[model samples]
Target: MKCIERIKYPEFDFKEYKASEGRHSVHDYPAMLHYLLVNHLIKNYSSENSLIYDPFCGSGVSIVESLKLNRKAFGTDINPLALLIADVRASNFETDRIRDVLDRFNIEWNNLTPDIPEVKNISYWFKDYVIKDLGKIRTFLRTVKDNEIFKFLLVVFSQTVRDVSNNRKGEFKRYRLSEEKLKQFTPNVRKTFISLVEKYLKIVETDIIPFTDFKLFLQDVRVSIPIKNVDLIITSPPYGDSKTTVAYGQFSSFSFDWLKGLNPYGDGDLKLDSLCLGGKKIKEQKELPSGHLYDALKNIEKIDEKRALEVYSFFYDYYLSIKQVVKTLNDNANVCFVVGNRTVKGIRIEMDFITAEFFESFGLTLENIFVREIANKRMPLKNSPSNITGKTSNTMLNEYIVIMRN
Candidate 1:
């Protein structure tokens, strides 16, 4: 295959095709890889029926797309909500079963008494009436018999949970609206849930494909390798540590908090960013394989010593995960890492070069690094990495798709 130095996706519209993506469009993920990009990568990287693996499959876009392209897939993530969304997306569902389940759920919602889970400071995020309505929906969901139908119904309700929450919309972090804004906030919780069920039912009907084998594991790739013999790896790992870049854990907290019992692997705590890659700080700094990474750390250190450590810790964990992943890849397998070069304290970290450097250290050949502008990728326009009010830095303008052969 020929390699291109850089690539542009002017024709790929993020919102271009809705029903075609099936369950992928049922929920939104922070910094999600568009369906078009995932589909294109799977088609080019692996043959039909080949095994594909995503180590950091957030919402399972790679898994869904791979199966849609007639390939088997495996996805692993530490985030319970992410795993649930991915699991629901990858599973095959019958439209008739889902409709029947929905019918029973509506009847149960009216009869069942509200069973509100004990979420820490739930009132701050939801009003009294809204809380009761959500509890009623959740209580009824617990009575569901079919596992697939239960998860599918829970996902739809989860969407409604985020939509009707006091948390400000379009922000990944848990920022509550002002008191003035709260006064005007009126959300019809029941209406929202029913409407979402109907909307996603249509998508589920369109996405019903023949049964394809796909597995989702609620395990961290950094600690354990769940599968082997991967022919292709298509994933977009967290660009930076969860706290600074995309707060995936924080973003999913609302829904996870409500559905913690259903999660087989969640720790009951909601600070998921701390458990994600680069979420922890390393006390010792050691030699790294990538010179580009070392130099970036030095540059960041000059600006802020603590900030440099944060960056170093993230990369260190990232390198460890790469090492673990290398052990699982079959010979001549391909890896596509969709990464963003984020600026911290005004120094742009060369993630693309660093990523290439890490893979090369493990005997993988760097094939190509295709740069694409962030036209519609959902991310904050700017962020204060330093946490100072005025110390703002622009987010990534583009992302690099670093393709390598193992």
Candidate 2:
């Protein structure tokens, strides 16, 4: 690795520092950026121990940032992988168990081997020897008595899977490497995992506070969220359905495939991406809370009614999720969303305008809509919005913040 400093971000006036100690760039939305929002907008109730909630807490950046500021952080998501990361990232470490684990693993590294679980085309995703090593690490991790250490270790393992897998890097969707590339490539899974474990452990030791109040759970925002009297509801939610938006499910499924067996959960958790906003099917909805979306759908209806219906369904689900967020918040509390409006069939859907109007319908006054150029993008710059070839554009160049009051 090389050391560099003073990188430039176009127009986002946020700080340039990092958040989590480990390489926790699972999804972008830096801590300093979030802290800036929390500091600037949330003036009414900025208590040190204020209850902060993020309903659609993808990767738990908001929740983690809240904890860092000595606030009570809580978040809910459908994906167990996200919960695991959030729990590990937000929680401060206690004992030197990680050191002990690392010491013992140094001696047992060669002897240990992976007990690979059953997955579709596992050979294609990972090499045979890599599988063996991963299985061994899994076996060793099972023997670990401490649950807290185990969770952080899972982050290391998850990163290892992503790093060593045949799936092309950077792209959220999993696509196996070409036969020539696969043949030529060789990865030292054990070394990489061990290095990451050390890095994460150091982060826990030096960065995290002794104790930070946080609760991360696997729950759909459209259904239920166990938070109340929330001081601030800040989140950068899923843009739309994961299929054409961002392949968060596909990005997480590889790691989750290995992790799900460690605990007892069904295939429902595996469908986290599909369970995202607008994941389900529905008819074209004209009965919209916001006229902006309805009009956009009308324009889209002329082009492709099927895709138009998809937008309606997504907003319908989004509307419900926003309602759930409102129910859990205290009176006069604020809800802010850092959302990117992706184009469908090359039509720019104004999520910021739509969200502000929808929130107004819920009796929440629209505070302001702040626009910022996306400096650190987690997703690819170019993509097919309609999931059809030749219908592509620059997706996340700019992001909008829709702030509303309860």
Candidate 3:
């Protein structure tokens, strides 16, 4: 079947789309859809050595898919933990060496002493025994000589922290944990770490590992990078302010606080306060719109101007950063961004429209827009509310795949 016929507008049957054979399906996102899009670009628009890029490469999905197709890949993220995961997933490593490191990690785990000062927040979330066990594992990880293996182990440990924490598995926001429940399933940090390492090892052994050049950086998309001429760019920027739809910072705080040295109040270059929003004063700066649509939304008057400005400014900064990165691409390069609209004060701000305006400002032509239904596997029924006025409304239910070209 033709590709265009396969991608029917409004009602693409994504359930029937199976991922490429032998591709590990552990990561989130529609792998088959992303594979089809990446494959299409490679077959029609790319040369053998074309450089593919994903600025907001969550879990390294686009870069991993690109590598499987023999394309050089570049990815960056503000989250250090994310960078570590991407680096391990994208790099070539010897299985035996990985196992050796795991063995050493186990030995070190057994002999480790919890001498390091305990983080106050860590103590607050985890029981005394749980905190001590986690601290021992983290301390051992710090002493590992193999940086790649250390990072992989870190990912394993980080992923397990959520499961072991008092936080509910399905809910991504902060929640108080009952002492009884915390005592029941306090994750054995070492045991979970070993199991996760083995699982990752099995995935690496079974899946196809295509030979392609790849790089991962703990850098923000808003800044310039070393790559001069990218051929294709694929990314999904953060959904406006972190507090709105997806609390990425809060969701990943366990790892971020331990590894990235993030301040509990978010006092870093990548903090939520640093983003550009339309209504709120962020970093002491007045609310400013990056485009007309945002300005129009700000003029609604019914919406809290301060809050709306903060949200708009955050998104605007992220959009502008992505635009700057796109500018570094080759003249013939194509860029695809996955984003969704968010509502404030019952007014839906068309994020896709705002993104289109930003891209147009960079002389890029809009190629296509694909709308996908919101299937949040993690937070399936947690926040079904369409409005956030009382935290009882389901605010967002759809996303847009905005495709453009230089």
lDDT leader: 1
Q: In candidate 1, what are the lDDT values of residues 1-406, reduced to their tens digit?
A: 1334566555544445542355777876777887788888999999998999999998888988998888999988888788888887887677688878778776776687888988889999999999999998878888877888888888887889899999887667788888999999999988899888888888877777554789888877778797999999999988888777777878888988788687544543556889889999999999889988888899989989998999999999999989888887999999999998888888889898898889899999988888766556767544464553222234567778899998
* Per-residue lDDT over 1-406 for candidate 3, one digit per residue giving the tens place of the 0 to 100 score: 0011112344422434454323324322211234444455455556667888888775676777788778889887665555566666676667789898777776677688863343446667766777777777767777767766666666676776665666765555556566776667656767877787787777777775576589876666666665769998877776665555555555566655455432211222225323322223445444333455656555644556665566656665766586578667999798877776665565666677667667877778777777765432222222333423223234455667777788
Distance from true location, Cα of 331 in model 3, Å: 1.1
Task: Quote each prediction's TM-score.
Answer: 0.93, 0.88, 0.81
Candidate 2: TM-score? 0.88
lDDT of 2 by residue, 1-406 (tens): 0111222333344536333224244322211234445445444435677888888776676776676677888888777777777777776666387888888887887787567788778887889888888888888888777888787787788888888899766546677777888888799988988888877777767766534788877788889777889978888777777777765677777787787666322233347667888888785355868877977888888999898888888899999988788889888887878777777777778888888877777788876667766444445433464354223245566777777778
Q: Poorest 10 consecutive residues of model 2 by lDDT?
A: 1-10
Model-by-model lDDT, in order? 0.82, 0.71, 0.61
**How close to the true structure is residue 226 of candidate 1, measured as C-alpha lDDT?**
71
Of 2 and 3, the candidate ahead on lDDT is 2
Q: What is the C-alpha RMSD of each candidate to the true structure, in Å?
A: 2.9, 6.2, 5.4
* Whole-model alpha-carbon lDDT for candidate 3: 0.61
Error in Å for residue 327 of model 3? 2.1
Full-model lDDT, candidate 2:
0.71
